[model samples]
Target: MTTAQAKTFITLFLAMLLTSCMVADSTPDNQWRIVDEGAYAADVSADAQLSVVSGINNGIHVWRFGEAQPLFQWSHQSEGGDQSNNLVANVHISADSLFAVTADREAFAIWSLTSGEPIGFWRIDESSIRDVAVSDNGRGVLVGRSNGKVMFFEPESGRRIEFLGHQERINSVDITPNGRYALTGGNDYVAYLWNTDSGQVIHTFTHPSRVTLVALDDEGRYAFTADSQQKSQIWNVQTGEPISQLQYIARQKIFTDAVFSKDGKYLLTGAPSRRLYLWEVATGKQVGEWKVAPRENMSPPSAVVYGVGFIDDKHVLSVSSSGLAELWSMP
Candidate 1:
């Protein structure tokens, strides 16, 4: 990276670290801000400039950092829009807020946020698109297929780089903040890290159960992996060594999402238990746990924290399976 780029990253890194030290809510109800609700999926950009919200019947929405209403929305119009509920899928927005990608069971399309029109529209594989992520560079797109193959795309070059490793459906794929590496986990019980540019396998971590989610820290130095069972481990990205087995009092066997703090000092894991667990990266010890539910209403309230990302070191943004979005204060 150039000096400017390095400095920029360093500045952002420090900002995240400082945020982790924030003196905010000691409890969920006291210190959290609910940003959205009634959405199936949502993701915040790396820079937190925009948020992508997916709905069962309303299609997709892109909103600015502080806006309550979306700047744009898109939906399907076939079969009286009934299947639109099932058609709603994952959404990814570039850190620079220049492009957005929305994926459903059938196809995933690229849209120019500035132009408010699609730039690329195509299917990834014979099966559904399980997960999608945009490289930090905002130009490369990484997609995991339900068939277990991962594809890398460049909008300008129209280059599709494919990597084959897993045997079952890929559950999640995450790009390092520097955009140098891609980490993936699948139902095949394996997690693989790929060189984003070359589409080459860098490291493969095998688990005892089906791999459900994988995440990389901002600098790509560490990767987190979780399986369908209550198993989670941290790996050294550079050496492919298992750093430690993350031990926690997890009520659910299936973990849905995981993310590392920007400083790489802490890790967060979420599951169907309607809670997020924070672990100390150095010791692999559970340091904190927070329930994800917004209130005490227990009418089928065991919602999973399906999508999670660090908005800053001190705050986190998460989307529950029931479609509620909240900006939560970190401990």
Candidate 2:
């Protein structure tokens, strides 16, 4: 990064600190539920029909909308200990909601959503797992590691392909629902859209700072990549061209989670300061904005939006670090 970019990043970081320190209720109106009190991590399926949450007290639990009881409950065994002591730091569910992955620092476990069974558990050899994603139908798993390596593994066939293009530790990763493509961002200030079959790069997206987050459209039409600084852009998945960069009044708007609309017309993003935004894909305009609630007894009065998905053309869903599942009307 250049000196100019470094100055811009510091300005943005201080702005975020000032905003987060404020006490206010920015939450918009919504129907909400307490899925898990003090959730450690959470994720929602692409269709918004299913959710998985891990709390401080228990293992991971998967819930179907409108159902009081969780559909499945599973736990990852902590290193040198039982499942009861595991603290899952990351959780991801497939777009089809057929599979989920839960991980800590050293290992990750894959689960089948339909039968509520543990499919497999794997431990990293020399590197720690940073993030993980499962392909629809449980055919593929993508694991980003702390040692600048990404693994594309097949559970049934026992095949593992490594993507070693990154020069620094990986930060985030996502896989296409069909398991054909992979997107990953890293501290190296670059994001790659690559073929999972051949381990080849199709497109490279560069940034001014470390790439913090990334996501892929379920239909493989678009890709979203954001850095720690001010740059957040969407790209054409087919043409490998830049589409539009998101516009914000702040020095920067850091996204913690993001998802593309099914029709590939809009993008939804969530941030640390209880912010949720809807952006027009073609024009890169801010068409809608909403905020999720912080925990009731929290000091800072802010929540990090962990997961977002479209319920339909008219509704949307979000899961937050606040341990609440909220349903919002489309704006």
lDDT of 1 by residue, 170-239 (tens): 9988876556688888888889988877878889899988888787776667888888777788999899
- Compared with the true structure, the alpha-carbon lDDT of candidate 1 equals 0.71
* Candidate no. 1 TM-score: 0.78
Q: Kindly give the number of clashing pairs for every candidate.
A: 4, 0
Top TM-score prediction, candidate number: 2
**Whole-model lDDT per candidate:** 0.71, 0.86
lDDT of 2 by residue, 1-331 (tens): 9999999999999999888645455454464554555677788888888889886666677877656778877768844666643678889999888999998877888898899988888878878889999999989999999999999999999999999999999999999998989999999999999999999999999999999999998888899999998889999988879899998767767887899898889899888888778899997888877778886688967678888888898877888878777777777
lDDT of 2 at 37: 57
